[model samples]
Target chain A: MPEIANTAAKVAVAMTVNGRLVSAELDPRTLLVQFLREKLLLTGTHVGCDTSQCGACVVHVDGAAVKSCTMLAIQADGMSVTTIEGLAGASGLHPMQEAFREHHGLQCGFCTPGMIMTALDMVARLGPDLDEATIRENLDGNLCRCTGYHNIVKAIGAGAAAMGAGAKVAAE
Target chain B: MYAFDYQRPAALADAAALLKADPEAKILAGGQTLLPTLKQRLAQPTALVDLARLPGLSAIEKTAEGVAIGALVKHAAVATSDVVRAAIPALADLAGLIGDPAVRNRGTLGGSLANDDPTADYPAAVLALNATVVTDRRSIGAGDYFQGLFTTALEEGEIITRVDFPQVERAGYAKFRNPASRYAMAGVFVAKTADAVRVAVTGAGQSGVFLWEEAGDILASDFSPAALARLELDPADLMSDLHGSAEYRAQLVKAMAKRAVAKALA
Candidate 1:
């Protein structure tokens, strides 16, 4: 057998996830997706493709949306992390998630949560006025095998509208 | 994936020192390639130096000279950033056109250029922009950095910190993407500098990436796609793959070069 590298069973890592401080004992080789699923038990982040090609394991890392599958759990040490579960605030559901549900945005729902997270990031960047082509182009990262994306686009548009209306209601 | 030692050093120098000390260690940027390779068991580095946590490396700044994009900057940040877009809209376009959204969010300039995948979008534009890749140790020209398929001039433990692109007067990038993967089947970067013109063609060359010499010659004559198409790229030297044939890619090179030129001038 070849000589193996050092594999310390447990390493201490800290993270600020969704406005909360967290520390966990993690394996040296543990991936972020595995950590979310196994260690932290935050299973809203799904792992569809081991390769970064599939956006099923998407999350908001340090306020930017990134594919969680591609990252190591240790890579996120001392960082702020957010999963699909973090999208909803004190409110019942995130406008994007609500819009997704209202517009029949999910079919298998395997890719829905990540879709919502990625759309949240996109909405944060492009704002409520994102057009159809830009939405399609921006949504290219998330893959939904079940839904053909017709309703997903509508969901994003409606989500933006909902977000915009919320802002208006808050102003009043 | 096999177990491995991992380090995330805060300082850029500390990261470089770690690599310099360990020859077998690989630099992990964005994990767009390294993690996938690890999962597939194609690559198992004894140790990985994660560049993600390094500070002062992901800066996209504009000086009087041109734009300097940190190697650690993700493709999505590059695509969405107004600073990057204003300086090199073609670069933003190239960044957006790279793999789907997930890949863009996770892939960094250094990872793509370091991997030097022949079909990657950055290398073509990097060469076309005549960007200088700055490593912890040295600054390498775009021509020198790229050698061939899966090849680069980087030495062991050399970490690319940033890429400095000399702002061109007008530029346009066009790509005929592989439908499924979105990697450029054939892409062209056409720039109109004050002194002269530069045309770099990628994804269609067996030599990996080549300057369209004949196209440049035509552009020198008229500086238009219509003028450039008069001089055709030799299909014999082009790359033939599962995606496209040598002759067909050669034609696309001509067409894309023309479109890029038209877009730049427009």
Candidate 2:
């Protein structure tokens, strides 16, 4: 039997979530998704499969998107995490969020948060001028049960372009 | 997931000490595979020793022989790294092809190699490229490292530090992936060095990743896809499951090899 199973031992975890420094004493088995949804009440990130296959629990860790369900909260100590809630500012919805709305990229909206988070990471890494094939290929990890991927792909392409345009305006 | 002690050791020696102290301790690299298994209750580890805080295990440097990639180097880093692309573009391409963007961001070369999943992509590349697995204790050649499915020569408490891939003249990889899971149903990696041609096949082998010695011999002289038109792997040596039959995987291995060779020539 595992030793910790008998004890009420909890690990201390501290990290920056959505630009806010948060800390909690959590069980070592607590996943990052559990930390976000159950502990912090930041329930924007959904758990579609609870496995690594679906990207519904996708969130940014230290600037790179990762599946939160597969990572333990203790493992995320001292790291910075960003979820869908962090995407928008007082200025309004992020360009990617706006693009999803304009493109009707969602049906049930269950996978929207993950899609937007992954889209922003893609734009940050692959640049804003993403092609159709590139967008489809990059969406391999994220699955939409509503089968609304056609519009999701369309949204990502338009979102990428808008992000590029927004960057240009900021630079000027 | 079962409750377990989580220890983050800042130094390599400390990490090794922790593992040595607890026989049931498991090292956490990227946690891409281990965490999933734990969540499913397939493993009941007493403790998890995280290597995240350990330094000097995440560098990718170009050596005189080839490229030395730290074990903790993420798949995304290898895929986008200018150094890896210049040294071994096929490796970069293979890394890019793993899972999805989010997976690539967290999966590491060491984690993949250590787990030694039968359908994993890295084993084919490691074998074909003639890489060396460096550890805290000793260096292991690729030929002797992989034993079978989910198995390696690593002993308890040992940890992989980095992998040194010797530069090859030409190399390419191609895989027939299970569409839903994105794991290789049959994958082939072909490499031509200064003196020899090497071919490694993964996902199809019944015993795990293996070198198609006959294919390598034929390619050494001809070095073309047309030369392998008549070659066929015995179905008895390939895997069969709900995804594909042994005969189907046998055919896929040959087809994927041809495609990989063609890609190398291109």
User: Which has the greatest DockQ?
Assistant: 2
Tell me, what's the RMSD of every candidate?
2.0, 1.3
* lDDT (0 to 1) per candidate: 0.84, 0.93
Best by lDDT: 2
Tens-digit lDDT track for model 2 on B56-115?
A: 999999999999999999999999999999998899989988888898988999999999
Q: For candidate 2, write residues A41-108 as lDDT tens digits.
A: 99999999998888999999999999999999988899999999999989999989999999989989
User: What is the Cα-based lDDT of residue A79 in candidate 1?
Assistant: 89
Q: Tell me the TM-score of each prediction against the true structure.
A: 0.94, 0.98
Candidate 2 CAPRI assessment class: medium
Q: What is the lDDT of residue B102 in candidate 1?
A: 64
